[model samples]
Structures are given as C-alpha cells and as structure tokens.
Target: MAADPGPTHPPQHPVLVVGGPTASGKSGLALALADRADGVVINADSMQVYADLRVITARPSPADEAAAPHALYGIVPASMRMSAARWRQRALAEIDAAHAAGRLPIVVGGTGLYLRSLMQGLSDIPDIPADVRQAAMDLQAAIGSPALHARLASIDPVTAARLHPTDSQRLIRAWEVMQATGRPISAWQADPPRDVPAHLSFTTLVVEPPRAVLYARCDRRFLAMLEQGAEQEVAALLGQKLDPALPAMKALGVPEIAALIEGRMDRATATATAQQLTRNYAKRQMTWFRNQMPAALRLDAMELASGTAFTKFYDRIMADMTKNITKMG
Candidate 1:
C-alpha cells in the first residue's frame, strides 16, 4: 500500500491474511486454511491483542487453537494500548517460526491498520512531547470531543475535517501532533509514503455480504454472545474501572452492555444497540477496504460455498503463489 514497489523476488517465507468484519467468518476461514496447511494462525486485530477480552473480543476460541497453531492472542494485558508496529514485529517472528517448522502462517482479523502495517512498514512517527499529549488528553478528559475539536479547528482544521465530531481520540491525536510539531497533521502526511518491506507472500479476502444478511448475522452473533456469558464478561471488565478512553471500554457492546449492567437498558435493548453498532462498523470497514486496500480479493458471503467466486478465488491465490515459488526455484 506504500509507494514501495515491494520485493522484486517472491517472498522466501509465505503467509496468508484472512480478514473481514466481525462475524463474517474470518476466524473460521483462518482455521480452515491453517488446517489444510498445518499452519500457525496469528492475530492481526487490535482488540484481540488484549488478554482480558477473550470472550468479549471474540478472540480465537479454544476449538480454533485445537484446529491449528495460533500466536499473539490474549497476550497483552488490559492496561496497554497496542499499535500495528508492535504486531508486525511479533507476526514476522511467528512467520519465521512457522516456516522453520514447515507450518503455514495464516494471519487473520479485520483491523485495517494491522494489515497495512504488515504489508507496508509503519511510518516511524516519533512520539509527541509529553506536555503536548498531556494537554490534549487533559482537554479530552475535561471538555470532551466538541471542546477538543475547537482547539484542533484553530490549529489543524484540515486534519480536524477528517475527524468526526464524536471521534475524540483522533481529535486529541491531531491536537497533540499540532502542539508538538507546530504543523497541521494533514500537511505532514503529504510527504511521499515510506516503503516498508512486504515480507510475506499473501492472499487477502474481503468478505462483503449483502447488508441485510450481514446485519442479521451481526444480530444473531450478539444474541449468541449473550448466551455465552457476554454479560458476565462486561460486568467483569466494568469492575476494573478502565479508563473510558481505553479501546476495550469502547468496543461495540461495552457501552450498551454497561447500560444493561446499570439497569438503564433491558437485555433486548442493549443487545440491539450492540448489533446496530456492529453493522455500522462493518459498513465502514467495507468502505475502507474498497478504497484503502484495493488489492484484497473481494468475496461475497451470500454464495460463499457454492459459486465460481470461491473456486476461482482459491485457484487464483494458489496459482499466483505457486508461480512465484516456481520462479524462485
């Protein structure tokens, strides 16, 4: 995705990235690929990176591990914020181990930033000055999104334009960037992009199902989670008083689930809210990949098993990798 032309030669080590929105069968597909190749599955999702979120985050289930080797799930603790740069280094090590053991590495999850970092080396954006970051965080903690946006509007309105009025974290980040660099964050991004080596040969799938059908699936999955102790999981995390700014606290179901816990909403209302948020997130995801990750092979989930889509899909990926390896030989 970077300006980098990428490797002229085929990657010596092969890897596969299986991605789609939540409840779109990404984990299932990763399991299938890993089973076929006797491979290791690595996590490429931001939420799944946290250890406290096994049930809530819908991380790889125990059955998934029994089906194939998996790395990087439930490793980071609840208190930390992980970035894509950290994940890429960890996944690269897992990829090396898989190859040495003659096992495949199937990277899976739906975080766009994670996949992009894997394919294009992350920009080494330096840390913002502590004073700047603290100022933004303090402002966010005090006056919230609108107030933060006012500050950003004065300095980096170009960057602020891309941020939704409710997108507090991003607005804070832009403000921090402005304070530290004295330049609009948008202007800084205009430089030619860096080329991080795309280390693995990969086949990516973008699962785009009919909106109605996918929405139904999201509702069903949320209800299924309710049956699976999702409420209890929310109660547990709420016990910790994690900062509202923390990513886990802001997962699709968290606020809704919290309301359920507080008796402000009934089970049905909370679950419905969660489902609506999930569907909206999926729509945003599809849009993002359409423009940002055009290389991903789009697959319609409506006719998943019985169509030329899946057949040609598998064949094209295999053939491309096979041709690359043969040429390498």
Candidate 2:
C-alpha cells in the first residue's frame, strides 16, 4: 500500500481568488473551501456589496453565511458608489484581519476590476470636481452613451477607442477626467500605481463552463430570484427614488422589474428581458476573465458544483497555493 501524505501546507498564508461569471457557483465553492481551509470569504462583487437588492443580486443566503466567516458583503448602501480603489482598501483590511485570525482569505466574485486592483494595483487618478462629474453625467443622459462616445473620440480618441460605445459608465469617466484635467485619462493610467503591498501571494481560479450551460444557468437563476422576492426587493429600492445612474439602481434585473412595477412592462416581458440581460452579462464576464487572467487555473462551472469534483479540486488548489507562494522573508 502507498504511504499516506500529510495535508499540504504553504510556508506563508496565500489568498485564494475565486472569480467567474454570475450563477457559476463561486459562492458555494468559496463557502466549502472556507470551511475546509478555515478561511474567510470576502466579497469582490460590486453588486453584492450594496446593502439593498440582496435578493435580486443573488448574494449568499443567511444560512450559508452562518456556516463560515464572510466579510464585505452587503455593507455599502446602494445610494453610494464604490470605486475599485476604495474596495481595494476595504478588502486589504479584511485580508489582514483574516490573516491575523489565522484563516485563509478567499476573495470571491466576478468583478474583474476589483480582483485586478488587489493583484496589480490601481492608477492614481485625481478625483474629478463635483461640477465636472455632474456635467459628464448630464451630457451622457442628454445625448446617450453612443453619442457621448463620439464626442469623446473628438477629444480623447485613444481612451475613447478602448471603451465600448455602449459602456456609459466608463465613457463618462474618461470624459470627466479629460475635462477635469488637460491630460487624457489614459495618461493618468500610465502613471505608476501606488498602494499595492508586497507581502501577499495569490492563487486564482476562474470557472468557465460551456457557454450553453452557463447561459441556461444564468436564465434559471434570474427566474429563481424572481420567485425569491426579487421583485419586492426592486420595488423597495425604487421606492427610495435614488438616482438612476447609481450602480445599485442599474444592477441586473432592477430596470426590468422596475418597469414591471410601473406598468410599462408586463410580467412575462420583464422576466424574459431580465433573463436575456443576465446571460449577456455572464458572457461578458467570461470573456473578461478568460482574456485578462492568463495565469488563473480554469475550472468548469459544473465541476465546481459537484461534490466529488470539488473535493479533488480543493486538493489541487492546496498544492497550487503551496507551490506558488512568493518568499517574503
């Protein structure tokens, strides 16, 4: 009989990042891994950070959260926007706290920017003046995102070319930066990044299932959320009458459900529309993770969801973490 080997352990604690498209079972994987590794699950999803729309956002349920330590989920109000830099600050503190308690830090979510900020750091872009910010928003609302992109091309062609014409948020940001400072936003981005600490090493896993399977999961999950009081969640959020541009207000399913409540859309139409949007968002997430995270260990979503496969995967991850650790001493 072969001799049994002891549990694999790294010389130093390593942060595990579980990134994937929505409805990809990242939360379940993270929860199970947290329990096995004595880790803390930290939220990296931008939508999941908002306190409102918990049901609509498909945040981990209370029962699941009770099974292990979780942090940075549903902490920020929907009325406020969270920048990548701000989230990095909060997430780093959480990681430090988790390390101090002798637990692994598992950062889980599909937010590429958030994960990137943690691993690669962020550029030092100066804050845009309030008036300048408002002007950019007003212009975007007045002319629509595509038209605004054209206007941006006239001034900052380099930055404008990189952003999708329909990417209203980023388009507005680039325009705002150009207007606030004489230099383009790309110039600011080229400056050396700050605030990244050198002590931590990371093992990242990205779940990318077959597209057909992922789309079906996305559709099913949105419908499940509706049955689980997502409509009520959206209605309550709309009752606050927050700015439409707010990230939470624009979260998936919010607009469709809000239209349903307002009588502008029928129930079936709203459900179908939201499901399609969710699938589209999932596709974008898959593309971003596949193209950006070259070094991540890719797993099939179905495997991550399976009990036997997940156990084997966890062992592989432990080996990877131990092998990939960067010496700090």
Candidate 3:
C-alpha cells in the first residue's frame, strides 16, 4: 500500500472546492476526496456554521468528521449572526493552516455567496453603521420587501435590477450601504476588492443533479431529518427565542418546523411545506452555482452518489494530482 502522505508531501496546488445544491452529496464527495488525499474539510455553507442546527442543516455527522479533519462546521452560536465576511476570514485562515501542515484544503458547501467571496474575492465596502443597518431593517419591516425593493430601485437601479423583489436581505444591504456611505452598493462593488492573495490556486467541482432526482432527494431528506431529531433541534432553538430575523432562524426547515412546534400547523402540512421550500431553495442554489462558477468542472450528483462512481472520480483526481506533482518536479 502507498503510504499516506501525512504532513510531508504537499501538492503544488493545494485547494479543492466542492459545491452543489442542498442534499446533492457535496459533503459525501468532500469526505471521499479528503480520505484519499489526506485533506482537511472546511465548511462553506452559510447554514452549516451555526452550532444549533447541525441535524436540520444536514451538516456532516460525527462519524464523517472523525474520518477527516473538518473545520468551521457548527462552530458559531445560533444567537450570533455570521456574515459572509467573517466566514471568509475564518476560511482563509483554515486554508492557510491546512497548507502549512501539508494537507489539501477541501472547501465544500451549497452557499454561493460564501464560495464567491472565497474564490472571486469580495468588495471592500466599509461596514454599515449599526444605526444605518437598523434603519434599513426597520424600513423593510414596515413597508415589506416589495416596497423596500422599489425604494432601492429609486436610489440604485443597477443593484435593484439584479435582486428579486422578495430578496429582503440584499435589498436591505444595498439600502444600508447607500445610506451609510452615500454611494450605491453597486458603485462600491465596481471598485476592486482589497485583499486577495495572488498565490492561491483552486480546483473547483460543481455537482448538479438531475432536477427530478434532486427534488426527490430533497423531499426524502427532510423526512429523514424529522425522523432524526430535527423537531427536537428546532424545539430547542425556539426555546431560546432568538431573534426571528437572525439568519439561523431562517434555515430551510426552521420556520416550518417552528410553526409546527408552536401549534400553528399540523405535522403533515409542515412536512409538506418544508419539503416544498427545500426544493425551491435547491432550485435557486442550482441556478446560482451554474451562473457564478462558470469555470468549475461540472458533474452530475449521481456520478458521485454510488461507491463505484465515487471510486472512479477519486482515482481521476489522484491521477491528476500525480501528474501535477510530476510536472512540478
């Protein structure tokens, strides 16, 4: 048997990013690759960061974590709001640490914004003041998403055109930026990002499953989550009464499950509603990954779903790594 590389022989290009829609086997693929390559798995999904919703968010199980080193999963408290910037900073540190220890850094998740911030870099817009942010949030709450979107369009048409009318988060962000800095968010974005190191190299893989198969998996997964203590998880979170506007509170199954727990809806209705929402969210994720990561290698999720297909995929990656190491030598 070939000896495990351990911490001795680092690859020339040391990062791999696996991204896909929810329930598309991204975590499985990342773990398989990590096992083969002696890599460290880092979280890139926004929802998986919260310490509260591990089961509901489908974060890697304890067995998977023991199989390889995993970072950033379930590290933050549910009460704290984790922004993309904070995640990016922590991820960069994890990537650097992995490389220093001669392990491949495997970043995997479904969150497009998080991945984009890591890969393409992010705008260096100054932080919005608390008052500005609060005002934007208050206005949105009072007038609703459509009205807030209309207001954003009046001040920043470019940013407004890119966002959906119901996209409360981005709408509030744009409004806050405009209110804080007296410049549109789009204008600030046109300026170059402040800190992207030129030395980093990334190998990206995007898994897009067939829609019918993916949707079915989404539905089945939610049912499985319920069986696997998701209701209790939400019940605990709700017991804390964290701000409803917090991102953790808005995870895919969270609101529906909360409604069910609060007696506002029955189990059957809540399950169906959560399943539908998961499918819709998955559709949006699929579209975002397709459009934003154009240069990434695209594979069907089914290609990595089975042991045989995954073995083939793993072998290909290893072969490529060997060739690259040879070329470097």
Candidate 4:
C-alpha cells in the first residue's frame, strides 16, 4: 500500500455569512450553500423577521423552507420592535444550537446593521433614559428629521454626515445618546463591545451585482411581490391597525401598497414609486456593504444567479474556508 496521506484542508469555520443588497440573489445562494454544507439557513434581514409582511418583504417561501431548516424568519410579530441587539441574542442561540447539532450556520440577509452587530459587536453607548428618549421624540416631532439632523450636525457632525437627512430613527438615536451621555454616538461606536464569542470564526461573502442590473432586479422583484399577494398582505396588515410608526409598517412596498389599497394612489403609480424606493435602498445597501466589509469575499451576484457560475462560486468558498482555517490554526 502507498504511504498514508495527510488531510488536504484545515477545519472549516462554524459560521458563514452571505450578505448583499436586496434582489442580489443572497437567499438563493444561502439556500444552496446550506444544503451543500448541511447547514441551517438563518435570517439576518430586518424586514423579513416580521410575521405580518412576508410577501412584501420577500422572505423565503414555504417551499424553500421545506428544503432546509431556516431560523429567525417571520418569528416576530409586527407590533413588536426587534432591535439588532435582540436579534443578535436570538442568532447566537441558533448558532450554538446548530453547532451542537453538528450543522453549519449560514446567516443570510441584506441588513448591514444586524450583520455588523454580530460580527463586530455593537457600540457601548449607555442606555438612554426613557424621559430623554421621549424628549428626543418630542424634538423630532416638532422640528422634523432634517431640522433635527441640522441640530445634530452642530453637535456631532460625524454621525450627522453619516446618516441620511431623512433617517429619523438614527437621528433621534444620536440626539438621545448625546443628551444622555454627553457624547456623540459616533464616539461610542469607535469602540465596540465583543458580542460574538472569541472561539467562533466567520467566513463572509458579499454579493455585488452591477448597479443597473441590481436596479432592474429590484424593480422586477417588487412587481413580482405585488403579483404574489403583496397587496393583500399590506391590506391585512393595515387592517390590524398596528401603529403606523412600527418598523414593519415601513417595510419596502408596504406603504405604497397600503396607499393603493386606500385609494390614495393607483396601482401603477404605487408600483413605480415602490420600485424607485427599492432601487435607492439597494444602492445604499451596496455602498454600505462595500465600505464596511472590505475584507469579505466579493462575488458578482449576476454570476452567482447562474447555475455554472454559482457552482464555481461555491467551490471557491469551500476552498477559501479551508485556507482561512489553516491560516488561523
């Protein structure tokens, strides 16, 4: 007999993250990778976590879930606000469970904040007092996001410049943090507390499709959502009379569909408006992933959507994982 040969590759990391902009075929790639790795597919998309807006959010369908175990999709009621901290706790539990069961954990979504919280941990800003939060809310209600953002710019230009003028939630958060801690939120984020355990390693892949191609997909996907009962989904959610301020109520396409349902807009107008918003959102997401995950593997989503290309991509991922593990060892 020939001499015994050593193993060819190192041990694989326990966690794999697939992230990108919307309509970048992340879900499909995650599903395929989970199947190949005997992994559980976990949701990291903020919108997809709400139970009420499945159709509008483009959550994985039942047929897809039937093919592999999926965690964290549609698990939270729309009435409840699921923060990134809350999601990180749930995701950690799921990851541990998957590991104990000898399965890989494949977390997939387009939510950059959630992924960031998991990988780099969250900022250690002190919790804002309820009174302080209420005060910030009052200020925002009185002056609006742009005016409040201008105020924030005076106090914390770094955070203000990073947030969009219309991003009310983050603006208010920055304002509240400053009020409570006498420090800018950006100052706190300069140092993050480790959330994930030190033992775990992650292999992150970011899908980057061409901007024009991604925009086209976003438009077509939104239209498909409408065709696949998105209107009814929105109507049902609106009927629940949940607070209009709820995050789920603000999901992409929900407001447009609700407007159509209420006769405030025609279907064509609603669809066009929603498509434009979706494309803009995808553009922002692409920029964020590009800036934040500089070291992550970058794959063109257009290629990954094709069968042959996806096979090559998967093989590359496996090889890279082995190489990463070897280096770490």
lDDT of 3 by residue, 1-329 (tens): 99886654333554788999998888888988899888999999998999999899999999999999999999899999888899999999999999899899999999887888887788988988899998888898899989999999999999998787866777888999999999999998888876764446676788888899999999999999999999999999999988776789889899899999999999999999999989988988888888888877788756666888878887776665556456543
Clashes of each: 1, 0, 0, 0
**Model 1: C-alpha RMSD to truth?**
4.9
Error of 4 at 295 (Å): 1.5
**Better candidate number, 1 or 3, judged by lDDT:** 3
Kindly list the per-residue Cα lDDT of model 2 for residues 152-266, writing each as its tens digit. 9998888887776876778988999999998888888788878766667888999788889988998999889988999889988998989887888889899899999999999
Q: Report the lDDT tens digits of candidate 1 across residue range 83-131.
A: 6667878888888889889987888888887887787666546678778
In model 1, state the lDDT of residue 3. Answer: 100
User: In model 2, what lDDT does residue 249 have?
Assistant: 83
Kindly give the stretch of ten consecutive residues in candidate 2 with the minimal lDDT sum: 4-13
In candidate 1 the C-alpha lDDT for residue 267 amounts to 81
Check candidate 1 and list the clashing pairs: 121-196
TM-score of each: 0.86, 0.92, 0.89, 0.91
Which pairs clash (backbone N, Cα, C closer than 3 Å) in model 2? none
User: Which wins on TM-score, candidate 1 or candidate 4?
Assistant: 4
| Candidate 2: stretches off by over 4 Å | 1-12, 304-307, 326-329
lDDT of each: 0.76, 0.88, 0.87, 0.87
Regions of model 4 farther than 4 Å from truth: 1-13, 305-308
